[model samples]
Target: MDFSFGPEDERFRAQARAWLAAHLVGPYAGLKGRGGPGSEHEGAEDRRGWERELGADGWIGLGWDRAHGGYGNRGATLTQQVVWAEEYARAQAPGRVGHIGENLLAPTLLAYGSPAQRDRFLPPIARGEELWCQGYSEPEAGSDLAGIRTAATLDAGDSGYRITGQKIWTSLAHEADWCFVLARTEAGSRRHHGLSFLLVPMDQPGRIEVRPIRQLSGTSEFNEVFFDGAAARAEHVVGGAGGGWQVAMGLLALERGVSTLVQQIGFASELGEVVRVALRTGAADEPTVRDRLVRQWAELQSMRWNALRTLGAQSGTGGQGRPGGADPGAASVAKLLWGGWHQRLGELAMQVRGAPAAVGPYDWSADRPYELDALQRLFLFTRADTIYGGSDEIQRTIIAERVLGLPKGARPST
Candidate 1:
C-alpha cells in the first residue's frame, strides 16, 4: 500500500490540527495531556465538555454512515480518520470521556440495532449527551466472557427485563448513563448460549450501584457495578434476545477499529516523553537505554504500518460497513502486538526515570496516602495491559486456532 498522504489528506490533517489548537483553550487549555490511561481522574467534567465540543464540530463518529448521524457514508476514509487521530494526539488534547459511547457502542448499534433503537441511542451519542460502559466482564468471567453469569429476567407485567448480577472492572461506569450488558435471558443455559445484549440505564436507585475501584495509580476510573433488578426495555435488546454472543463478539471486533490508530498515537506520545526524560536525565548516554529507545522508535513505526495494513484489509472487504465481518484473527494479533509493546514501554519508562521511579508523594494525613508521577503511574497501569483486554495466553490461542487452523485447545471440565 502507498503510505504517502495526498494533498486532500494533508489538508484534512491541517484542518484537524488547527481545530484542536483553537478549541483547546480557556478552561480546556490546562487539560492538555492531563487525562490518559492512568490519569483518567483529571479534569473529567471539563473533558466531557471537550467531548461535546468535538461533537458540535462533527469530529465524533467519523467512521459511521451519515444516515446514522455521522459525517457521511463510510463517514471518513481510513486515511482521514488516521489524520484526525494523529493530530489529536499531537495536540496533547485531553483524553476523551465519551470514547466508549462513540467508538464501541455507537458502531455496534449501527450494525445490529433496529431503526428505533438507532434513532434513540445514536443521536445522544453523536451529540455527546450521554456516555456508555461495557457490561461484559464479571467478577467470575473477565477474559472468559463465555462464563458471564449476569442474568436478566423478563418482567411479567412490563416490556422490560430485570438485571441482577455484578460487573467488575467496568471502566467509567460511574460516569456512564447506560450500559450495554451481555446477560443470560434463558434459564439453565450454559456458556455463550441464552445470552442477550441489553441496554440498561444506570440512574435507577435500588437497582443499580456503581462503586469505584481505586487503582494503584490513585484513580477510580474503573468501577465495580452492581445490578439489583436494574431494568431495560424489550426494544433495547440488540440483535434480538438469545443473540448476544454474536452481538458481543461484533462489538469486540469494533473495539479494534480505527480507534487502534488513535491508541498508537497516544503510545507514541508516551514513548516520546520517555525519550525526552532519558535524554535530560543522561539515561540516554547509557548504551543499553539508548538501544532500547531506538528499538521502541522502530517498533512504533512498525505498529503504525501494521495498523494501516489492517485498516486497508477491512476497507477492501467492505468490513467498514459490516463491522462484524472484519478479520477476527487480525483483532487478536493487534491486541497481542500492542498489549506486549505497551507493557514493555512501561518498564522502559521506569528505567529512564531511574531511582526517582521508586518515590511518590506519601502523606498519611492526606485523603490519598500516595501520589505517583506519570512514569510510575504508567508502569503500574500498563502492567495490566496484557491482562485486561485479553491475556497473552488467550490471544495466542486465538491466533493459533483461528488464524493457523491449529487444533483447538482442550477445555477444562466444569
Candidate 2:
C-alpha cells in the first residue's frame, strides 16, 4: 500500500485539524482527552453535545455513501476517514458518544436492512440525535453468541415482537437512546438459528431497565440491561427474522473497521504518556524497560500499516468500502494483535509506575470509597481487553477454523 497521501488528502487533513481546533472550545475544551474506556462516566452529557456538534458539521458518517445520508460525494475515501480519525485523536478530542451507532449499526443497516428500516433509522443516527448500545452478550453468551437465550415473541397484534431476557456487560446502556438486540424469535430453535436483530427503543416504561455495573476503576459505564417484554416494531427488524446470524456477523466485522485505527491513535497517545512517565521517574534508565518501550513503539507502527493494508483490500472489493468487512482473517488478526498488545501495555504502565501504582485514591470518604488515577484505570480496565469484544481464545479459533480451514474443535455440553 502506498504510504504517501495525495495533495487532496493533505488538504482534507488540514480542514479536519482546523475544525477540531475551532470547535473544541469552552466546555468542549476541557473535554479533550476525557471520556475514554474506563473514564466513560466523565462529562457524558458534555460529550453527547459534542457528538451533535460533530454531526452538525457533517463529520459523523464519513464512510457512508451520500444516498444513505453521508458525505460520500465530497470524497469520503478510506484515506480521508483515516485522516479524520488521526486528527481527532491528535487534538485529544473527547471520545465519541455515538460510536456504537455510527460505526457498527449504521453500516450493518446499509448492508442488510430494508429500505424502510434505513429511511427510518439512519437519519437520527446520522444527525447524532440518538445513541446506540449493543445487546449481543448475555450471561451465558459472551463470546459464544450462538448460546444466547434472549427470546422474543411476536405480538398479538403483529405490529412488533416482545423481547424478554437479560444482557450483561452492556456498555453505555444507561446513556443510549436505542439498542440493537439479537433475540431468539423461533420457539425451540437452538444456537444461531431462530435469531432476529431487533432495534429497540431504550425508554420503554415498564419493559426496559438499566442498572450500571461498577468497575474496578470505580466507574459505571457498563451496565446490566433487563428487557421484560420490550417491544420492537415489526419494521424495526434488520435482515428478517431467523436470518439475524448473518447480519450480526456483519456488524461484528464492522466492529473491527476504521474505529480500530482510531483506537490505535488513542493507544499511541497513552503510550507516549507512559514513555514520559518512565523518563521522569528514571524507569527509562533501566535497559529492559527502555527495550520494551522501543518494541511497543515499533509494534504500534506495524499495526497501523496492517490496518491500512486490510482496509485497502476491503475497499478494492467494492463492499462497504471500509475495513474488515471483506476479510474475516483481517478482522480476527487485528483483534488478536491489539487485544494482547493492550493488555501488555497495561502491565507496562503499572511497571513503570513502580510502587506508586499500588496506591488508590487519596479520598477514602464514604461517598468516594475508591478512586483510580488514569494509569491505574488503564491497567485495571485493559485486563478485560483480552476478554471482552471477542476474547483471545475466540480470535485464535476463528483464525484456526475459519481462515486456515482447520478441523472444528469439540464443543462442551451446556
Candidate 3:
C-alpha cells in the first residue's frame, strides 16, 4: 500500500496545524505536552477545557461516518484523518482527555448500537460534553474477561437494570461522567454467555463510588470503582443485552487506524528524551547502552510501518469499529510489539542514569508528596505495560489460535 500523502492531504495537515496553533494558546498555552500515560494527574481540568475547545471548533470526531449523523462534526477521508493525527502529535498538543469517549465508545456505538442508541450517546461524546471510562476489567477477570462477576439485575418496572459489583484498574474513573460496563445479566449464566454491556451514569452518590488507586509514580489516574445497584436505563444497552462479549471484543479491535499513529509519536518523544539523557550523562559511550538505543530506534520504525499497513487495511474496509472485521492478528500483534518495547525502554531509561536512577531528591522527612523526575515516572509506570490492555501472554495466545490456526489452548471450565 502507498504510504505517501498528496497535495490535498498536505492542505488538510496545514489546516489542522493552523487551527491547533491558534487555539492551543491564551489560557491553554501551558497545556502543551501535559497529561498522558505516566503524567495523567497533571492539568486534568485544563485538559477538559481543551477537549471542549476541540469540540467547539469541529475537531472532535473527524472520522465518524456522516451517514451516521456525523456525531461530532463533518467526516474526513482516511488520509485526512491520518494527517490530522500527525499534525496533532507534531504540535506537541496536550494529551487528549476525550479519547476514550471519542475513540473507544463512540466507534462501538456506531457499529453495534441501534440508531436510537447512537442518537442518544454519540452527540455528547462528539461535543466533549461527556467523559467515559471502560469497565471490562474486574478484580478477578482482568485478562479472563468472561469470568467477570459484576451482576446487573432488571430493576422494578423493567425500565432499567441495577448494577452491583466492583470494577478495579478503571482509568480516569474519578473524572468520568459515565462508564460502559460489562455485567452478568442472566441469573444462572456463567462466563461470557449471559453478559450485557451497559452504559451507567456516574452521578449516583449513594450507588456509585470512585476511589483512586495511587500508583508508584504518586498519580491516581487509575481507580477502583464500586457500584451498589447503580441504575442503567434499559435503552442504554449497546449490542443488546446478553451479547456483551462480542461488543466488548469489537471495542478492543477498534485500536487500529490513526490511534496507532498517535502512539508512535508519543514513543518517539520518549525515546528522544532517553537519548538526550544518555548524551548528557556520557552513557552513550557504553557499547551496551548504544546498542540498546539503536535497537529501540529500529523497532520503533518497524512498528510505524506495521501501523501504516494496518491503517491501510482498515481504510479499505470502511474504517474502525466494524464488528467481526479486520485481521484478528493485527490488534494482538500491535499490543505485543509495543507492550514489551515500552517496558524495555523504561528499563533503559534507568540504566542510562546508572546509580542515580534509584534515588529521589525529596527528603523522606517531609509529609508532602515527592516530585519525581520524568525518567523515574516512566520507569515506575511501565512496569505494568505488559500487564494492562491484554497481557503479552494473552496477545500471543490470541495470535496463535486465531491467526496461526494452531490447536487452541485450554480454557478454564465456565
Better of 2 and 3 by lDDT: 2
**Can you tell me which runs of candidate 1 are displaced by over 4 Å?**
67-74, 317-320, 324-326, 361-370, 412-414
Q: What is the TM-score of each candidate against the true structure?
A: 0.95, 0.96, 0.96
> Tens digits of per-residue lDDT for model 3 on 1-414?
887899988988889999999988998999888887889888999999988888888898898888676674867877788789888878889888889999888888988888898888888888888999999898888988988999999987889999999999999898889999999999989878999999999999999999999898888889999999999999999988898999998888885557877888888999999999999999999999999999999999999999888877776646644743668899989988999899999999999999999887766688655588888998999999999999889989989999999998788776
Q: Residue 341: error of model 2 in Å?
A: 0.5
lDDT: which is higher, 1 or 3?
A: 3
Residues 1-414 of candidate 2: C-alpha lDDT, one tens digit per residue: 785788989999999999999999998999989999999988999999998998888888888877554433243888899999999999999989999999899888888887788778777887889999999999889999888999999988888999999999999999999999999999998888899999999999889999999887778989999999999998898989898898898888878778999999999999999999999999999999999999999999999999888777776744454335566788889988998888889999999989998987665466665568889999999989998998889889999998899999986453
Worst 10 residues of 1 by lDDT: 65-74
Model 1 scores what on Cα lDDT? 0.87
State model 3's lDDT: 0.88
The residue ranges of model 2 lying beyond 4 angstroms of the native Cα positions read 67-75, 317-325, 364-370, 412-414
Candidates 1 and 3 compared by TM-score, better number: 3
In model 2, the clashing pairs are none
lDDT of 2: 0.88
- In model 3, which runs have C-alpha deviations exceeding 4 angstroms? 363-369
